[model samples]
Target chain A: MARTRLTPEREHELYTAVLDLLGEVGYEALTMDAVAARTRSSKATLYRQWGSKAELVVRALRNDKPVHLAEIDTGTLRGDFLAVLGRSDDCRMEKNSALLRGLSHAVHDNPDLFQALRELLIEPEMTGLQLLLERAVERGEVRPDNPALSYVPHMMIGAFAARELIDERPVDRAFLLDYAESVVFPALGV
Target chain B: MARTRLTPEREHELYTAVLDLLGEVGYEALTMDAVAARTRSSKATLYRQWGSKAELVVRALRNDKPVHLAEIDTGTLRGDFLAVLGRSDDCRMEKNSALLRGLSHAVHDNPDLFQALRELLIEPEMTGLQLLLERAVERGEVRPDNPALSYVPHMMIGAFAARELIDERPVDRAFLLDYAESVVFPALGV
Candidate 1:
């Protein structure tokens, strides 16, 4: 007999479980069975809901951002960037094992992973930063043609991944934000 | 029976093969067996020479500094940064699939990949830039206490990588240099 299909609530529950696994295992070691077992859902339900581990993880990441990236309200460009890029936040630093491992491993093996990573991980952050920079440009705080303007957000965040994955550091938010204000913003002339 | 160790002439042949493979197959897909076949050395010899992929790759990157980076002689700091970065001659921004994959993958697993990448990639260019900045400081073109001096390398190069990896475009060196001059140097109170 077929088991009753997983409801939206149940799927979200599993997604929460997936996030937990992502934190625990990193992407390389995260497996379908593990996610299923942890969530108390069958592998069949997981596959039916999200198709594969990558899809499930991407789904979870998609769900994670609205909760993680809190709204920032600092008035100055430096203040706003600092608020958004708080070094105390896990998402801001390179220490989110799941996000990095997922991006690194997923890009190599699955186009879906790459697309999803770009959409979920890269896009939201880029768009958020563009909005920030646009605001700064309007306030006349930053140059309209600042080249680092186009690239700094991505660079600041990506450097964390590069540092942890390559430099073997913990990728803490303090270190990242300090580096950003000291290096990135100054380079942007703001 | 033991086979004779590879001669220095044979070792050089093998190192060249690794470079070609690094630019061709990437770090993850490369293997000792494949390298042996490329170099016409037996797998035993390859294993005997290097224990892991990380070690082998580090050796390859450390082999020698090419004329490309050392040749930049632009009269100004901004010109020098532009000349070395985003230029086609050095393949710095080329984003060779094999090379990036290798670097990205190897760095994730090995502790030493960071040092190798720094020494092989980031440090050479940064060291040169540091010298240029020092000269500028002596000439009173820039301040000795400029905060931008501490981390511009990461800002510029990290910006380029972020543009390539996330934005999915070829990094614009001209933009980077312009950013340095218009935004970065000026903010340094130069």
Candidate 2:
């Protein structure tokens, strides 16, 4: 079905509406009618633009993530990680935590959504981090064979999940700093 | 509601039924009626015993996890981790993964269920891991104040999650061995 493209501003509005709804009711309960009512877009428009709820949510997740890595070169791998971790303020982190919690189940249920999420969000972020790690290895700040390179992103994800599930602690600047110095740097053998 | 207590064997049957149903239908779609039908237990009996579907599922998760850490003391932390990681073969790991996938969404939605899951399953396992780490520190295999102490459980959880979400890899004996040697040991500076 041919569909009219939304203007960038209109698309942003739809994405915001979907993400907010997702956080509120979760993916299972989120509906096109609700999105239409919230964003004042017609149901036909939404269905035409994005074929299904999964597609809409996937695009919203992609849009929510920062398109590129925050350009970071702090002269060392630890410095770069600290810098990147510090970039997300408490408010953003909280929002992300809630959004992620709401979407966690849906990601597992919908393989296509999960695949898209990894490709769009996880892969890009990992690639950027990989580049940052390579730079550190080049400068001899970290070993070329450090296995932490592969698992750092996973650990960071786990750290976020842990904070949410285990402690319900704030993944704020102070905590990330502690994690970087204590868990991350030592893991890197730095 | 004062409920009739089943014998240990019957309770085990119910828990198995709940977990199996959870794997088949997921938390959202799972119903008490389905569990009753599957196990051929009356709905009244189920409700009387567990109070709710959430409680039933929580008990199932608790029952599925190993109650002890397999009594591992391999003289070194690395060897101990390998022993613990190698304890579960493909089958148990597969069941745990499926059960976790089924509950991931519901855990965030239901606080009481989440609390029970942590207290019953996650905490016991972490306490056991903590003991293992302390033993390593006594043997001088790892530093007493390694930051990885606080984060190892989270990392282990992350490793499971990353395997599920990022790579879609099997969290098998080999993968855990690699993760322990690469990510876990180095993080501990062992």
Candidate 3:
């Protein structure tokens, strides 16, 4: 049977439906049938388009998220840090956090999903962040061997996870500013 | 039928079983029936002791994990920091990380579980860390109003998580020490 390819609009709808279902049911409980029912698409169509649920979810994340860090040449490292961290404000923090949390368990079980998330979803962001740091190092804003250089992503992502899991707070503008000033800046020797 | 109260040994067994199941099955799919089957305990007894799966898992974590940080007074703030962060070694890090990852999805779904985890598991550790900081302050090893003091938990926890999620590395003793020396101590002005 010939598979019906979805238009870009339909593909986006499929992605939204997949992410929403993931947030609700998690990767373990999410089934193609549920996605089909929710999107009024067929299981065959989903499978035809993406071989597995993990592939579908990974694509959805890649498509929806700002995978590449925008050219954030803010001149100062502090400015660049704020520009990057502040972008989270544009994201649906609760939904994103919930989705990550739900997928947290299943990622370990599925190597393909884990690799896709790391390579496709997370790696690009890390590259952009590192580039930003590299530019700063060139300008003598930060030292080349500063250990905090390697941990910039960790601190930011960790803080994001901590905010959701432990603090139960939103990573708002004020919070990012405080974090940059108090946490990232000091560590980076800014 | 009268419910049989579990002795300390039985309770310990139950906690171990629940935690083991949580690492294996995750919180969403974990059921009272599965727990009963795994532990060879009656579902009625399980329900009688703990109201729900959330309660069971929470109690299990509190019992199995070090809910409180021990006296980590290493005289210096850096020493105390190393002592506290170094404790991941004594834990079943892989199992604990898996258990945490599995529960990440459901923690937000169940407020009771979230509250129990934060209060019982995380808050006490935070208190111990703060005591370590206070002693450092008294000894003039750290300043009274250093902004870094407030963010110590966030930095350490964030680094731990970042190492796991982004770096795809273990928060082993060597990694923790390197992190403390390079990232943490610099931030704290030690």
lDDT (Cα, tens digit) per residue for candidate 3, span B30-123? 8999999999988988888888777788889878764356567778877766666566563576667667765665775778877777877788
Error of 2 at A132 (Å): 1.9
Model 2: runs farther than 4 Å from truth?
A1-14, A28-56, A109-112, B1-14, B28-56, B70-75
Mark the 10 consecutive residues where model 1 chain B has the least summed lDDT.
B89-98
Residue-level lDDT of model 1, residues B3-64, one tens digit each, is 56767776677777888888787776888888878877777776677766666776665553
Model 2, range A1-190, lDDT digits (tens) per residue? Answer: 5667789998998998899898888887889999999999899889888877878888897687643564678887777866766666778777877777666667766787766767767777778887888898899888888877788777777787787667667677777777777777777778
Cα-lDDT of candidate 1: 0.66
Full candidate order by TM-score, most accurate first: 2, 3, 1
How many Å off is the CA of A53 in candidate 3? 4.9
Compute the DockQ of candidate 1: 0.39
Candidates' C-alpha lDDT? 0.66, 0.78, 0.78
Give the alpha carbon lDDT tens digit for every residue of A1-190 in model 1. Answer: 5656767787678778888788787777889989878877778877876777777888786665533333554666788866655534665333345466656755776787777777666777667767777888888988897766766665575556456434456766576677766666776676
Top candidate on DockQ is 2
DockQ per candidate: 0.39, 0.59, 0.51
Q: What is the TM-score of each predicted model, taking all chains together?
A: 0.75, 0.83, 0.76
| TM-score-better candidate, 1 vs 2 | 2
Q: Which of 2 and 3 is the better model by DockQ?
A: 2
